[model samples]
Target: MSQIFDFSGNEEFYHGGSIYSNPKEAGSFLSLGIVNHVDVYFPNKRARISAPLVPGGESLEQKKQVSLDVLPDECLYEILRRLPGDQERSSCASVSKRWLMLLSSIPSADLCNKFEVVAEEGDEIESDGFLTRSLEGKKATDVRLAAIAVGSGGRGGLGKLTIRGSNSVRGVTDLGLKAVARCCPSLKSVSLWNVSSVGDEGLVEIANGCHRLEKLDLCNCPSITNKALFAIAKNCPTLTSLSIEGCQYIGNEGVQAIGQFCPNLKSVTIKDCPLVGDQGVASLMSSASFVLTKLKLQGLNVTDLSLAVIGHYGKTVTDLVLANLQNVNEKGFWVMGNAQGLQHLRSFTISSCRGVTDVAVEAVGKGCPNLKQFVLKKCAFMSDNGLMSFAKAARSLESLQIEECHRITQIGFFGLLLNCGPKLKALTMSSCFGFKDMILGFPLPNKSAPLRSVTVSNCPGLGDMTLAMLAKLCPQLQCVNFHGLPYITDAGLLSLIESCDAGAGLVKVGLSGCVNVTDNVVIALAKYHGGTLEVLNLEGCGKVTDAGLVAIADDCLVLNELDVSKCAITDFGVATLARSKQLSLQILSLSGCSMLSDKCLPFLVKLGQSLMGMNLQNCNSISSSVIDMLVGRLFRCDILS
Candidate 1:
């Protein structure tokens, strides 16, 4: 055949039987012809025919089918690098001996994220063996050991270390942790979850040795006392963030030490630390006045006596959380009420404080004029008068949460909404009897001040009219949560989804307790903004099914966190969510999804690398095998019982 020929001169490609005259088309046509001939000749070895075989140093262009053997080392390395993580890399190694050899030769730093030492159950020498192995294999020295002892005759590592343990490791004493800390010199972040054995001594060792430590999470570590704070303040002068939530032994003294010594501290959280009183918090605020910007003091024993002390020194705080301050009364509020320098404060949460009346609530609005986020839940005494105060004072407020407040009636709520409509971007109103029918008829935000989110849960009075009104006024609303509104049906929810401005911004939604809502509403949401929705809490909702979940998983690319706990979803829905190829999901809660079984757990294992939190509490079908696989895959995840 001629290499080059005009259409008029040659009929080889047109009239001839073969389509191999042109080079580009010839290669593809020849490949197809060869594949067909191979399949016909070697029917039993058709699978083998698909596998490309080539000689060493041969180019990929020489083979009809692309051969893995001909790829350059650098090109193959790049291809392996593009795989998701080590799990995927390991699967690729099984393809052939070349891949397996290449993966084994690669450095641990390039092949692994971090050194992980996992101790088997009832293995006495497990800790020592793992530590010895880790010390022997040194590519880059940052190790994470789970449920393994690292000090006090256990095992020790010289590299940067992270020690995480469960309740099963009762022998993991403070001395054990201290031994590891004394051994390691390059530690940066120490996150201790549910490890009650660690006390002040162990923490002090970490503070002293890890001078460059930036993050310290001690959640549910109850034995951490004031002595730990002294050690931290004295040694880790560069500590920037510290969380001491659920540490029962820590008191005002520890906080005072942090205030006095940690000059560079920027964030501090003391959630559910009952011994940390108002005075201790006040001392911390006064000491770290210039540097502290993020402070969370939830469930502390702070009272009205310390309000003045906090207000004086905490004026510069940007993110402040004081939820469940049971002793916070009118007096304490008045002290903060009169603060003059709290204009910089942005986010504030003061929920579950029964002592705080409308007077105290009003004072905060007056005192912190620049406050943008305000969460006031179970504040029984807050009424229309307090709403008036907020309207008059806090014009910059954007997010407001007023749930379980019985005193706020429809008339007052409407009046307050009218004032906040211009500035409010997110609003949550729940369990209030007064705003029932009135909210349905009330006008909402203007074009200039469009609402982005609204959550109305357990509000029995809210009907179709109220939703229609909200849909009309807040055209830019991205999320609307109506958890317990029985009156709302598919019509109301459909209207809201359809009214989404340009169908781009609406992301999350909740109709959990809306008994009237059916599959129709769920389908509507899945059809509209399912691509962007990340959280869809349909707990106790009997309407949704596998069809709706499949629709959502297929459309939503960014859906990461989902809470379908207690819903009637079956294994079909669970399988769909677990097998999603989007790769963005990180948390899935199927606590009460009874129909889901162990069949879908393998998919969860495949998808578990990115997951950080998962809840499978009451899923009876899941056994120990699934748990083992999940634990192995999700190294840094928090899995609840």
Candidate 2:
């Protein structure tokens, strides 16, 4: 008899089998004394053949049947890569030793280039292995950045790393900047806010290594000096945007270096750099670095010479900010008036520049023909003449902010209200003491101005008449902020709330610090126009209580942000206020309110995942546990408490 051979369907090839058949096709009718199984038939005389009956036993069969191992490693790697985030991938890595080994071998996982470790309180520094892995014994010249949360995470292999913490990043003796200098061939952007320890050497190290760095924001990094800046000019040729906002040590040397090396520089913000002078600025402009489109020289000692340089070569400037440049005088304006190529200018902000008069501003108005935004704050010398000049030339203006310019009287702004040809969309004027009822008396357009939004805060002189006129004239007004407007009582707001819209579209109203505003107007607003009102800011309205809030909650289902901080409300009031079922509140600022501690927790927690931002600053009653409950692990909070 010929040796019987058992066949396996799963195998790609059969072992020691002369013929094969499936059981489903075979029938007992084909042969007697046989089950419904396959049988092989031979046409010629049978020949003797010797073969193993069951091949190489069960173990061989088991090994051959495992088809998962037969799939390509690349395919398996792709499958792993498709998983979301690290925690899920880490779980897959733990399934088996083979999976662990395979996952470890993946180049994407092996590189481990970007790691952010946010430290929780009581989490021991020794337990953080991620920092050790990132900083120790790695050779990656192409590595870009390794960001670690302050108060946690180690300074690892140092290619390019950003340390964000409450404490200053001191000399990296343990995991210091030397590691970055040694390993990182290129470092680009470094931001260290409130970091006190980073001195001149560490900054110099980054400047030397990161040749292609474009933006360097050292906000409040006070120890940085001209020496470090000199190194940056020598090493980083592509540096464009530099902000040393609070660095006191920077002087003329730093400015000269920026002019020489980074000729194509665009944006520069140097606030509170006391040593900067007109000569340094002149040197910067004379270096043929005319490509500067944005320049901010705040809190510097720049004078007429600096202004002349800017007018000569910086005609291509788009956004020029000279806030607190005390030395800029009326002569500077004459030079700026002759600027020929400043046609593309869009935004200009000059705040606290006491020397800037109507002359300089008028020159700016004339020179920059395409100006779209003009913000002049604390320019005490600015008057109606300057504002009229700006309004006449900047007919294409869209947004304007005039803050703390006490000299710009109501007559100045009335020019915009009456004769200005441009249609304004947004306007903000705060602390302008010259604002009076004359602004309201200005003749409205035959069809009213196309004003949509207006914010007039700390303008004490703007009386009720002005508010009424704003409501009547700006028919399309959708939002208004009348903060700290003491004279605007409920009478003005009543008119506004009643006539905001004939049927629909009135959305937001901010009446914070309006001392005379009462609950009657707010309640009336809630009852009549609740459907359209989305944001209501009644902060510091001492007279508003539960009655107004309950009415708002019951009526205005679309209310998203309700700033009733400093209002006279209890826990019950907060609960009643937040009871609106369809309210999708994203930001809630209840700062300075003593009643919103444990009282508002249950109601706030009911918001669940809908609330994204909340400000509980100065709220003395809120405990830490409430914060933990509201935020959980996914909280990205900005707390200054």
Candidate 3:
């Protein structure tokens, strides 16, 4: 008997070109000793395929069609999870919408572990063993961030994330950060810049989730406050570096919490945070269980009390930078130095601080016995007496840089050179109005100074005599940079270079903006130090011509970087350089050389074999098409046209 079943209530079903609205119709089709099958798919449900028996109690044998769409969601997810690479999974997802949903459901942590396993098998992991991702402007959206939270797991764990300047309408908010926090537990460093949409909630989530975070930088994030910082202090115990800038809401309480909780903190930088005061600075310096090695405080409201605390408690500090502290006076620096706790300080920078006077300078020199590098800028009160005294007292100082110190005269400058220890290897002075070419009765140093680098720039008062004096004092100079000194003629530079020791050849020579410098200086440099010269900058020296370029090409075999912007060099010089078989030039800048045209493009292309970067801005004779052609030919070089 052919048992008939009713299918009238169900929707129309089709099989083998037959529409079977009821069981009787379906029975007729089945009566031919053929098994009829119907495949149905339901949304959010497992797919099912059913077949009915024939009248003779026999079932028709047929081949079943199988595909990813017909598979169960759990099965599909497992298949996607087992895929060895992100590219493979991505290819699968592109097939249909169902695969994409399944792929997104996989746990990112598991994917990260699987990726690590694969990396270990293939030996593809980098030495750092980390992945970095950045989101900026329109890209800083919750959907994209969520994708990163998931996709980054498949390649390698996300170790660093940077979010800069979010979209004004749909910027990254707590939701995006929360997604990151939920998935990327391996995150070690995070930087947020100008992201006003993210607030304390997002940061708190990160702090609670990424306990291994070692560095955090927040700049211009107005919404972040003490709450987020406090949360981080309590949760991120291994935090080693922290920088907060332009966050008005962050004050002493947040810093105090960090000082009290984060015992392993190594570096702290707080800039333009007006609310920070003495208590916060004191706590950060005195409350830390371990010695802080670096501290930078700028544009803060803290006074001398903070400096005193730092001087007393910062026994192991190696680097300290204090700038624009209007409230701090000479008394504070004097007291801090007199305390003598900066015995291990190696590098110290003071800029635009009223406290950097003669008294404070001498105190610092006498106090920091191990100080090796000192940089003073815009210290108007610092005169020759204090500089001379500092030179005499700082026996261990090896590098001194003075900028815009109008009170430092030629007498003090000479005294510094004479009194500073023989270990002083670098001296940089710029924009000092007090450095006048005055006759000095004191005898020059009896022996050649051990100074290897000297840079003097933009000092109208400095002249040929100053360079002559420098040449007499330091005969073993390896790097010389003189800029914007119109008085420095070829005679001065020639004297300096000729005095250099033969064995210690000049490695870098920069005479940019020295209008008085002509091809003679360049020719002298090529003849005397070209074999060892690696970097030569003659930018703005309009008097230089192709002769200098020819000399450099002929002699500077190892020269890798050369800048001759605004010079009088033509195609002849460029062609000469291109034909040089020995020149290993990597970086070339010919900006503002209007004389150069399409004629020089071929020559530059020839030189681009080993060149990594080139700049030809303002070369009007060369059209954009030619520049584009040059760029195409030199695919590996970065061209700034």
Candidate 4:
């Protein structure tokens, strides 16, 4: 008897006498089992055929798959040009050699246009460069630096490069910088922070290669010395801004080189450089006097002579900051003011300096006629007399900030406020222990001052009477912030807000840490200033409850930002806020409100529709899973849980 066998299924058939129909039978098959003549029919359409295995049992006719590499060069170039950032393009370049070449061939102008498009969509793009790259920590490898140097050649030439920290064993060296120097001639700004591996050799390479360098910021880079600055001074003539902080080896010589060679330098900030003394500062001031507009000297060993030179030669200087200069004396500050060369000075800030005395401050006020803003911090010797004298001298002064000034008593504080010109628009006072409600001798001004904002913080001596006095003095105040004032109550805040002129309404009010503030203040805000009030921060006001939030939701139609953290708010309050039709709040903070739980999740998710930022930190009662779900739903909102 003959049995027919079909090979259409590609199943193996054994030549045994008995039929072995099991397809699972394993072994090589020599022939079909008991088969006579068999005929096969063919279809009209072509069918895929399995090729016979080779000696190694691998198929020779493997299928091919399409990929980005297979695309045309022009197509790849367009794709790379549309990448959001250099890091993304760099990642794509690592895929293949063809991609790297295509990415490098992209024009700089096209990359710049892509950056502009990204910026318009609210993404941060470096202002100084059309292309920017940063290498940090372990990623700061010479190989990657070399790659950036080669890859960024065609993509608008790296506009800015930042190298921060490096690998512990082996990191970026002179070789990497040399590669960048050789390739990126259009480099404009370079920032090196805590990158100890890089020294003068690498910096000089950059200075020699990138002649268009405009800004250089070096912070805690101990390896850098004077030689690099000299090279930059000689080569980079268009250098406009230079900041050197904690670079101990960089001394007067480097600064002097910059002063002499970089005549177009507009801003110079030299901080904590022990070697920088009178000579370097004087040279920089005198040589670059024509165009220098801003100067900041902090933690330096310079003396009065430097200040004298600045006063004499800083004719074009408009902004000056002097901080932590123990070597500078009152004589130096007085002489600087007496020079009368700071005619164009607009803003001056002095902090943690022993030389800031009443005499020096009064002299500065008398000299800088055009000075518009003045800030003083941690000046232990500065008293009310100095403050009053300065206030009287600075006629163009529009803003003043005084912090940690212990000697500025209520007399001097009120005297300065009373003597200040109508141009004064903003005043900030913090940690002034001498401020008190006592105003018996000082007479209040009959007409409201033109001041638009006032911030008084941590002054325990300040009381209700002072707030009433300020309310009467600055009725047109649009912004008020009183924090850590234990003596201030609802009545004090009430007086300040109620005293606002009919035409002038409070736009921003902050009563943070004022435990005595209650829902009454919120009700008052919703009643009088609700139409114009846009920012209300009542954080740490334990007395505030759901009633306050309900009032805010009902009346504060144009409110844009509200902070009720650490208040006695519950789910009902959040639900009320979420259901409000008129409130289009963009930022909301309910951190530390222990009463909030998973039940408030739906309401918060509803509120997240209009919120750009929400802080739910320390709300331990709310489940993490709920927050995770809310995060997935609120794709547009930034939640900090």
Candidate 5:
């Protein structure tokens, strides 16, 4: 019965006598990682006894299997507090009366991410800003505001509001924004996409009301201008982030107003505004007080002066994106190099600036210690020396894109991968003819890192083994685009699919101009990765026939976006796709498929409400009457013939 006895000293354990004698032998046997069962014996007396029952898994697991009778309310509350607010909390709240009672007692803020306001289908807000018509026919913003009004006073303690619209709902004019302004006072974030009618009057009202707004996105709202920006700065002083894209009338004045007023503005993205210029950028650098962490400006006419201002003031800038700054040269970049502010630069993108050369890039590489994304598109003067210098210096660079940079050779392009290949996640090199076969699949001495995305489209020198090598090395790749590689055959495509984790991870595969691709590669794709493939484009693959189409329809149940333009497929193949009940076919292109006729139209309507855009541009068989019929019947889907 001694507690401390080695196995060597215990003779009974050696002979399989009683296992309960020495506790040390039993503890040692149990410590050997036994899971299912353990054996301990007594030779003199034979007996069959059941072992102690182990605790079960976490399907409602808590202290003693989550029994309400066994645990106190405090312990139950603590366990529920650890559960995630969304699904786990909801599931626990639904389990029993006791759980429901406890969940009701917890504070709503701790139990939820954000109180959401979503307008139900067929629910409409009346012109007078009242809820009516199932809340469907009214403008999306109005209905959301009405929901906030009806829920818990105005605003309903709402933190996030999303008002998405279509043709059925009325356009979001000034009235809708005013409704949101009146109802949602605590709004912190708002996303307005596809609404063109929202102008300065409505935005001014929103700015006047939503003082606590931290994030505002006016993407595709082109009508707003300087007055609205001035109003926003005056009202929303706490605004930390703002995005204004595709706003036509917004110019230097609005940028100046935003910079002068919003002191806490940490991030600003002004893209596609042709009117913004160097003056606006200079004012921004001067008045914003250089507290910006992210800044993206496009379509701005700026010279070396703008770059100098940015380098001088933007010490805390992490992402600096400037496009169409044509006059910037080596001197501007050299001035920026001395700023010491760029030491924390993460993303540096300068496109359409042909004046930038290797000197600018070297200057940037020396200062940007944590540079992750380096993109220089249409920078004609950039060469191999500049690229290698940046690549060698910025050790954390994960993405490298060099488009239309004609001076880069294999030494620069491949040398980048040779040094930074282990950490590179995305590599896009297009129109670079100097990139050839040997560099792509060349073996590295160390373990290869998996790239998430790779686009070598229009690079003619790429050989057949390049894809196979990528298949072996980059298994996590989601998008592989070799759009104009005419010589690619089943060898590369098949190796790509088969080598992946059964090809289930691939999301988008583009082989548009791959003339040699045939049904064999498609069949391999359908066999392995049918469930996960989303966008499959074989636009110019002339060899794929009806058999391949049917195979894709049968296997690729989740495939929605497909383009078989100029392929060898006929009406019979398309009819098979039309009959597929599981596939949610959305954007389809049958352009240049000479064999497809009007018979395919009836089959296409079977897609019901899901089909959005259908292009039949070059099909000679479809009549004008059929096109008219398509326009009439499929009002929701775009028809092009």
Candidate 6:
């Protein structure tokens, strides 16, 4: 017989054999039998000559436990790369020490195409840059990070590695940072919040090792000084966005270096760095190749000189935040007003800039035509004159946060709201004592009141009528916070919930200091809108007792956060939350609840890992022993005392 099978089929080749058990058609398997020739084919690939097969003599269980040495390394890698997450890959590595070693030898980047991968769902909020990984708390330790670097041989295509500060991250040091720099050559972004151990030297190591770094966030890393900035200016030319918040030592020299080297820099945020004066800022702006866009300078020492430079060269700027720059007087804003470049400004936030008066504000208002967001915090000097111009010019406004702006009265403030029409979506006027009932009394277009969130906390002048009007006007409001409005009673709460689509849309409701709010409103919420209510805060409402809490515990299964702090609730009220199987509560604040004790701990312990935050501050009856035991059980919860 010929060595090659001469049998032919439509687009199929056969594996031929001199002696065969059973002769079969192209693609089907041939059984073992006495025959002259055997022919078999595979669907996708060309067929080869038949060879004697050896059946696995091992048991089925033994085969599963066997090492992957039988398969080629490439084949094993190909299979492992398809896993969904790191946890799944870790699971595969747990089969044996050999498997573990094999996986450890390969870079995680090679196993997955994505350079950076967020480990959890919440990480999306913090994810920034080309490759960003944000793992909140101490889920990722320095030791673990170092091990990953060593296992992957530093060739991991990771761009960003963000480990948010928590209790465990305090132990991380330069040793771990050095390991990462030595291995991961593709690292572009690194955010180590509160990692004080990493000094200028470690930063230098990163700057030298990863030159492609574009975005860097070193929040609260106090140890890093100007040396780190100098190194970055020399090495990192592609740097664009940089946040050196609370790094007190780096000043003018560092800022000057950034100006000289990083010509492509777009956004630069520096908080609490008083040494960076106008000279440093001017040098940075003078040499910039591209238009400067975003700049956030928040600190007591940031002066008018820097502000003047911003107004002079900040024409291309879209988002401007000059927060906490107390030294920036009305004169600095005058410079910005004259700068015709600020005409295209979209978002303007001058928070805690106490010197900002109506004179400078009025100029900015007249110039900036496309202002989408305007936030004025602690700018008490700004009066109706500035607001009138701002509101008239900024008809495209969507969000307004006027916290601590006492000078802005109903007329001045409403001037902006009146022109907002349907464009307004969020309104936060906390501590604006000027707010009165009439501010919200005016009729708003039901379809045009596109307001999704309304927070008017500490505005004591507002009453039940305002709340009722808000609900009636904005039926789709998802969050309503009128915390310090004492006059908002049960009638308003019920009317608000009933008139609005609270059952379907309202997720957060805050009546924190409404002393008159009672069980009637609480029971109404559970009966009518418990399903959509995720966070319900009745803090300081002394009238809400066990009956109100019990109603919520029984009906609101989806309540993730509940605050009844300073309320007249005892262990019975706290116990109701722990006993409820349906309520997988994440945050429970019982601060100042004098009657709460050890009796409630057992039920709370049942929540296990579900609880994220628990405030038991000033609970005189709850002894230290109960707290100790509770902390031991709920290790992850932020147990505040």
lDDT of 5 by residue, 571-605 (tens): 89988988777888889998999998888878767
User: What residue runs in model 6 are displaced by over 4 Å at the alpha carbon?
Assistant: 1-209, 215-231, 245-256, 289-292, 300-318, 334-346, 410-415, 434-448, 460-476, 491-505, 527-531, 549-560, 569-641
Model 3, residue 522: displacement in angstroms? 1.8
Reference-based TM-score of each model: 0.58, 0.66, 0.82, 0.80, 0.57, 0.61
Poorest lDDT segment (10 consecutive residues) of candidate 5: 57-66
Candidate 4 stretches greater than 4 Å from native: 1-129
lDDT digits (tens) for residues 387-436 of candidate 4:
88898888899999999999998788677778898799999999988776
lDDT for each residue of candidate 3 in 142-168, tens digit (9 for 90 to 100): 666766665665565789999999988
C-alpha positional error of residue 216 in candidate 3 after TM-score superposition, expressed in Å:
1.3
Rank the candidate models, highest TM-score first: 3, 4, 2, 6, 1, 5
- Per-residue lDDT of 606 in model 4: 90
Off by over 4 Å in 5: 1-261, 267-287, 296-309, 334-338, 421-423, 433-443, 460-465, 578-584, 605-613, 624-641
lDDT of each structure? Answer: 0.67, 0.66, 0.84, 0.84, 0.71, 0.72
Superior by TM-score: candidate 4 or candidate 6: 4
lDDT of 6: 0.72
Output the better candidate (1/6) by TM-score: 6
| Candidate 5 RMSD to the correct structure | 25.9
* Candidate 2 lDDT (Cα, 0 to 1): 0.66
TM-score of 1: 0.58
Candidate 1, number of clashes: 1
Candidates sorted by lDDT, best first: 4, 3, 6, 5, 1, 2
Backbone clashes in model 5, listed as residue pairs: 122-134, 122-136, 123-134, 123-135, 123-136, 124-135, 124-136
Q: How displaced is residue 207 in candidate 3, in Å?
A: 2.0
